[model samples]
Target: MTESETVRLGARIRAYRTMRRLTVRGLAGLAGASPSFVSQLERGRTSASVGMLRRISGALGITVADLFNEDDGAGHRVVRRLERPELPAGPGTRKYLISQRPLQNLEVYAGEFEPGASTGGEPYSHGDSQEILLVLRGRVTVWLGPPAEAVANTLAPGDSVEYRTSIPHRVVNDGDGTAEVLWVVSPPTPL
Candidate 1:
């Protein structure tokens, strides 16, 4: 691989690794490689053999081809509407994954909730990711932090919010009709 290609490949590895919350040492152990080796790969200091790429890809729960996908403006990708993957969320809620394949450091999903639908019964906490929810239709109430002391924000169309993933959060369709929302998370956390 060329120097630029190596760097870009390294970035892809770093993105997925962080999304999976794995340290260099952790991924190295899983790939049966050394921490320094992983670090050097991430820093574009070395080229991996097909065998090594397979090991790393296996350790990252992805395929070797995923590491070699054509760059979307250097990892920025366009996820078309029809191409977006559907995800299982709550009942009466339609969710679509927005990140283009190879699953990088970003996780984005668009959701449509019918009346009486919700994200879940309780809030959820995540690692060190940042989350943003933008309302595209109707209304919804977002509960943040502990249930007893939660702060509720009723959002309408065009409304958006940014919050820390450390705080427990959930969404409820507070409208009489269907509601739509776009959620984006950075350093993407698991569902």
Candidate 2:
């Protein structure tokens, strides 16, 4: 990354960390990093690898893409399709941040997944908010709760589901082809 970009990244990290009310040490512990490392990274004195950035973003309940965007969800009423920032995902999976940063009441995302791609191997919860997932193409399976006692629902085009964000959940593309989905969350929460 360029010098300016690195500084901006550090600023974003600091902003999110502060907004989450986490100290440098707390963030380091959650991200499996050292406090000094996080401090330096936030101060723009150092750079982080992709792996480190992913871990930190995960710990902060945000997407890596959020670290690069500067939009604060103010004054902009529309987000152009070609200008949407993308979140790093697993192979064959694409996640886009359709909503601006420092989310107000709502957060949105659009995703495309190749067959067999999934959000993750395990379910994860963000906070106490409401979420709606709508399938726009192909098929997907939504898993709620831990793997041991999870509820799975297969969704086709136009299918939608509403659930609490506090409940651990995962989404998988279980179709024969690529699947597209839209996620809308109210009272925006991290992750």
Task: Say which candidate scores most in lDDT.
Answer: 2
Model number with the top TM-score: 1
Task: Supply candidate 1's per-residue lDDT for 38.
Answer: 96
lDDT of 1 by residue, 107-142 (tens): 788999999899899998876578899999999999
Q: Estimate each model's TM-score.
A: 0.70, 0.62
RMSD (Cα, Å) for all candidates, in order, is: 4.5, 7.2
After superposition, the stretches of candidate 1 with alpha carbons farther than 4 Å from their true spots are 1-12, 15-37, 40-64, 70-80
Error of 1 at 48 (Å): 9.4
Tell me the tens digit of each residue's lDDT in model 2 across 41-130. Answer: 998989999999999998777788878878875565677998999999888899998877655457899999999999988898886678
Model 1 residue-pair collision total: 0
Q: List where candidate 2 sits over 4 angstroms from the true fold.
A: 1-76
Colliding residue pairs in candidate 1: none
Alpha carbon lDDT at 84, candidate 2? 90
For candidate 2, the TM-score is: 0.62
